[model samples]
Target: MSEVAMKPEIRVLETADADTFWKLRLRGLKEDPEAFGASLADSVDATHEEICKRLACTDDSFALGAFNPEPCGMLGFYRRQGERVRHKGSIWGVYVAPEARGTGLARRLMVEAIERAKKMPGLEEVLLTVSTTQGPAMKLYESLGFKEYGHEVKALKQGDLYIDEKAMMLRLHD
Candidate 1:
């Protein structure tokens, strides 16, 4: 039998969503170690207060959540702080619940994040890094207009295994 897919409604996560978001964030880090720059062991003990502070958004940075009535995915955007670097932003901590894969939820999350980045003052581009082995994820980013700009060897290591990543960027301005 074929599976039915449900669409996710995307929104900017709020302070009230800290616990839910944090739980999912930890799951992503633990379940998919190579896909992230941060490690589960490093952040597993993070407090709810810390997560709440992160859910708090400013004019330049925030996390977007995908809701199918529940928080199922998240993507974060952050603008560079210095005056000279404010024109650029980065997409981070992108994760979708395993059961929600193939439902176009991730593409929606990226689109939402990129659209929001485009509206940020002085921001002209958004950047991300994806592990070379994550072909499906790389394909999604490429399909969304993120181009590979460079590569780093052994960028992330879990024990003796090293994972490489390609630096990618999507231009928002001409």
Candidate 2:
């Protein structure tokens, strides 16, 4: 197949996409357990019903997926709930299938997420956490104008190793 043919098309995920979203998310957690707080093994016990509820919630949260005619990767973001923190949002659960990596799908997903975030009323900035081991991801975030604001020690643990994560932010001007 050609390069473009192999690349997945990016789109906003809908409520009816619970199973596909869950499967892609679990795959990401399995491939990079340290990249996120959730573990694939732990989520394996979660039912599609739970996922459907999450996806259907109409709030300051949203998910986007990339599909090769089938869901292959996904990203999610949510705004803080408290009135004091409502202006800020956090990005999480960013993952692409192993087969979809290095094809610019992740960047496309990020762009879509960022665009959606900017449209949110009263939003000030978007933040994300990335492990030090995720060098490529860090570079991608930086290229998109995200700056390192701080770091958390032992933010994640896998096996006996503790991984530190860098907190990055991108400010949106009103």
Candidate 3:
């Protein structure tokens, strides 16, 4: 079967995947700047070591990657560390290449992240911010039990263009 017709492998990325991850991330930033809080200029200078460090997954922080033999989608998750806020975690940098879209890859990645979050001790909720322009993403988060708790106007600015964002939370425990 064609690779695209087969199920892509999805797993927590490791340091070895840094090169592919970085490339895909740069593609995402360049293709859709407003969809992310990060800018190509901000990430263009990132060194290999820095990218490797980011992929060093711990129990509380990690990135997931989808690969049909090459990186096609990515997501990052990190739990807060302060004693007063350790029960919360945040999801960031979600992106799927255009070729990987409409394959249910985004939802699959989110479900994997949520499942991992549920396993972390003391984690009561998972938080994520989606630009208002990302209607499909907002709907996907809502479908996965996330509720909008707040909205931030001008949450992100890309070249004088303001991007509003909605903060959503998924309660995992009482």
* Top lDDT prediction, candidate number: 3
TM-score of 2: 0.91
Model 2 misplacement above 4 A: 1-7, 57-59
Ranking by TM-score: 3, 1, 2
What are the Cα lDDT values of the candidates? 0.89, 0.85, 0.92
Look at candidate 1 and tell me the lDDT of residue 153.
99
TM-score of each: 0.94, 0.91, 0.95
Segments of candidate 1 deviating more than 4 angstroms: 1-6
Number of the predicted model whose TM-score against the real structure is largest: 3
The candidate, 1 or 3, that scores higher on TM-score is 3
Please report the TM-score between candidate 3 and the true structure.
Answer: 0.95
RMSD of 1: 2.6
Q: Between 1 and 2, whose TM-score is larger?
A: 1
